[model samples]
Target: MSINLEGFVRRKTKLKLGGKEWIFNELSLADFARLRAKMAKERKVNLAERRKQLIEEAKGIGDIDPLKLLEHLDKPVTDEEMDAEMESIEGVGYMAYLSLKYAYPEVTEEDALKMLSIDKIEVVVGAMMGGLSGDKKKPKAKAKPV
Candidate 1:
């Protein structure tokens, strides 16, 4: 004879199982269904939604093709929007940006114009490390200046 275990579950109460009497917390039927639906919706959007929002906001300031944005999708990004799609890498510096620009000639001021569209602000974070924070690591001292 086949039995449906779900029928045995108490709506919102705890369930004790087996000879050892192991107990597990169970949510109310409504709450369980609601939580499952919410999780599914969240999983559907999450990162992709943030990327789209960031691209939309960036485009608002000027004209840009979403496809061009796709070229740099897998690349590092600047957090210049409400969605804050990209994160600030802790140890990156100005030299790193210059090196990156030097390495990838395609990442020009024009690309910056497309991404952030801020000419005076110059290169984006990936291009020039966004002009490093004022805080700097202390320089090592010379041994015995005497």
Candidate 2:
């Protein structure tokens, strides 16, 4: 017998951003991975572009300790760094696009742009990252019939 899981679900929210209300749904694991992949791709491109320059700049340094140079390379990024990166314009836009795409699969690129703006991107990012919780309406206490 299969058990029902209908009661377990993330909240869908309706909030104003860019002077308009857009309903947003929680990002699925795949959706979140896509955003992370976008950022990782950018980081890879930057490192590739700077590889030659970095090597040339480091030339003539007698003793090279590769371990010391890349010791923290494998370390995971800190939460603060991730937060700061998401706050950037590119990150904010991509995040907003992903959020919208997840919420509305039929959303167009033009509409996605319209959904996010400079003044409200932070709020949108915050909501997506769980920095703000007031977006969800609170339920009132049930009263007993007298």
Candidate 3:
């Protein structure tokens, strides 16, 4: 017997932070493939090495200008936002990385930092993986003839 899957194409959730509301669209297989390709191209290292490098880089920098890491993101950043501080830029980057698309109107750098203070890029990535895993269907077991 085949399991019928309907109405499972897109999933959306709302997130509230710093008196602002944001919508998150569940990632699809295509999104995962894109993310994997982006990461492979940007990091060019294994996961363990990448983690170590990230930690080392963070420790090495006294004042990190997040805009410098804009190349790591899948989306383009405007020149105006490029001058913003690290936290805000990272927040926007993290959100954009996980979601299909997002927009924030008149979002001040300070506001973005405040809104995304508790969110970690790693967590968003893990959530994306989990969402993808949940979408997969388990293999059906074969029936034994009597």
lDDT of 1 at 133: 27
Worst-scoring 10-residue span by lDDT in model 1 = 11-20
Q: Write the per-residue lDDT of candidate 3 for residues 1-95, one digit (tens) a residue.
A: 96786755556545554575665566566664554455445544454565556556866895764445434542444434333421355534544
| Model 2 residue 132 lDDT score | 68
lDDT of 3 at 66: 42
- TM-score of each candidate structure, all chains considered together: 0.19, 0.62, 0.35
Poorly placed runs, candidate 2 (over 4 Å) = 1-8, 16-20, 28-30, 60-78, 108-114, 126-146
lDDT of each: 0.37, 0.64, 0.49
**lDDT tens string, model 2, 25-126?**
666666666766766666666765465555554565747644454443434555676678766776666666777775678886567666676766656655
Residue 58, model 2: Cα distance from true site in angstroms: 0.7
Give the clash count for each candidate: 0, 0, 0
Which residue segments of model 1 deviate by more than 4 Å?
A: 1-46, 75-146
Clashing pairs in 2: none
Q: Give the higher-lDDT candidate: 1 or 2.
A: 2
Preferred candidate (lDDT higher): 2 or 3? 2
Report the backbone clash tally of model 1: 0
The number of the candidate with the highest TM-score is 2
Candidate rank order under lDDT: 2, 3, 1
Question: By summed lDDT, which 10 consecutive residues of candidate 3 come out lowest?
Answer: 78-87
